[model samples]
Target: MQKIVPNIWFDGTAAEAAEHYARVLPDTSGRVLMRYPEEGLPDFQKALAGQPLTAEIVVGESAEDGGCRIVLINAGPEFAPNESISFMLNFDPSRDPDAAATLEAVWAGLGDGGEVLAELDEYPFSPRYGWIRDRYGVTWQLILTHPDGEPRPFVIPSLLFCGAAQNRAKAAIAAYTSLFDDSGVGMIVDYSTATGAVRADSVMFGDFRLAGQWFTAVDSPEPRDFSFTCGVSLQVNCADQAEIDRCWEALSAVPEAEQCGWCADEFGLSWQIVPEEMGSLMASPEAYGAMLAMKKIVIADFPK
Candidate 1:
């Protein structure tokens, strides 16, 4: 029942990726809604088009679809996953009379500096959108007209991981499920082919529920760029500083850790241990001075 769900990536081009993607989709708003982990927000990286671990972008759905709902993550290179994960969009069939046409237009825009996989085609499953690794080597599948058109704007039901790192998929799935409550592996199909005949779908692909969102992961032989950093960060709304520190300490425990709340976990995935009320606090005049004082902060900075 998540209205606007995005299975994002943190390739070096988070801002560029968001800007590029925003151009193709209908909404087309000014770039940048929010950037996080004050110290982690890089100056040279942004100029170099480096990946971002924390970002919020507005794509698809202009005024009709209801504001910029989709978000991207540039959480840094440590957290970059191959095409095994992607974002899926569910267009409103009843309202979008020319869904195919609109979808194709979007494809063309995003495809400007990117590659196309299946082109814009009506598949047996649904009117689908497919694109292989973009210029940044990120894969995406944009689907239109949900099977039931049930006002489900978007869903990350599962993620598809491809490339030489199939085994890594299992490790990532297991690690993530352990961190969040109500998380467990759903369906898994592993290595079922004609006696070791490695078809594209030979590896394992399954579903998992993390936090409250549903996602899928798979392993394929596709090569991926190690360009993903901490640009696209998962925005967790914490109840208090206790919750923030609990998740932060648990996730960011690797050497690749950076300031401004970005860190690589033991699993190589990047995360931001940001406060839930940080956004509201920063928007205030008083907090702005404190924000400028330090790149990263704890609860004491914004005491109750």
Candidate 2:
């Protein structure tokens, strides 16, 4: 299983979104998990009964596994996807003969009910590139990869620290790298000119490794109406309770935001410090009930 996975929250469209991606993207698949009402928990059960609560999806292929696994949840409309976090899709012609065609197909599929943030065109960064927000409000940055540059994963999560968090990208990257084993900071390019609210010399673009996964981050100077929310989060699956506690101690900043193993870091990015055995324990209604009542997960509550 992936140690760290991206979790996407949607307003009851998680299953539909997952199905769309499974059909549109090559080498991808999705499975939905429903939440049925349980006895003795009237309010909680009533709120989630018969809901297609979660969707697990795999996209692209990885050397360690088939692809990246993401969790999607129908968690209501309290939060919505924004540019604060987006996925970057890299299509390398050298790796796939049908790269260009695949890119066009994906662009059209995603653009069906989406709005283009950056039109596809040649830029100094790549020959073909575009940024778009899909119907579900999830943003994606698609680029025809340069054959000469270092190879990267098929899909990578990108963090844009905008608004009040502007210029704090480096700090967040540092914190994450330090928290995860086998992690390190990579190339970082600073902004050359002040753009809107962002200052020059702040991170323009950078890459970092956390738990052996590469993720990009940038300090966007552009003003935005939204900041980081629970709409998107990074779930870190720990080997044991010790690992979970350590991560929770290091990453959690807003005490009030901590709930059911979920927390918000100092940079406002959300994270879930979950135990590796959570999947198996969650199968039991009693364990699930215990999970709902706790702020942080307790392994002892679930029987081995």
Task: Estimate, for each residue in 134-185, the C-alpha lDDT of model 2 and write its tens digit.
Answer: 9999999999998888877888899999876778998888888988888998
Cα lDDT, model 1, residue 266: 56
Question: Distance (Å) between predicted and true CA of 38, model 2?
Answer: 3.8
> What is the Cα-based lDDT of residue 239 in candidate 2?
93
For each candidate in turn, the TM-score is: 0.63, 0.95
Regions of candidate 1 where Cα sits further than 4 Å from its true position: 1-23, 26-31, 34-55, 59-85, 91-98, 117-129, 132-139, 144-165, 181-187, 193-203, 222-228, 281-297, 301-304
Q: Give the per-residue lDDT of model 1 (tens digit) for 7-49.
A: 3565456677666665666665434545544443346444433
lDDT of the structure predicted as candidate 2: 0.85
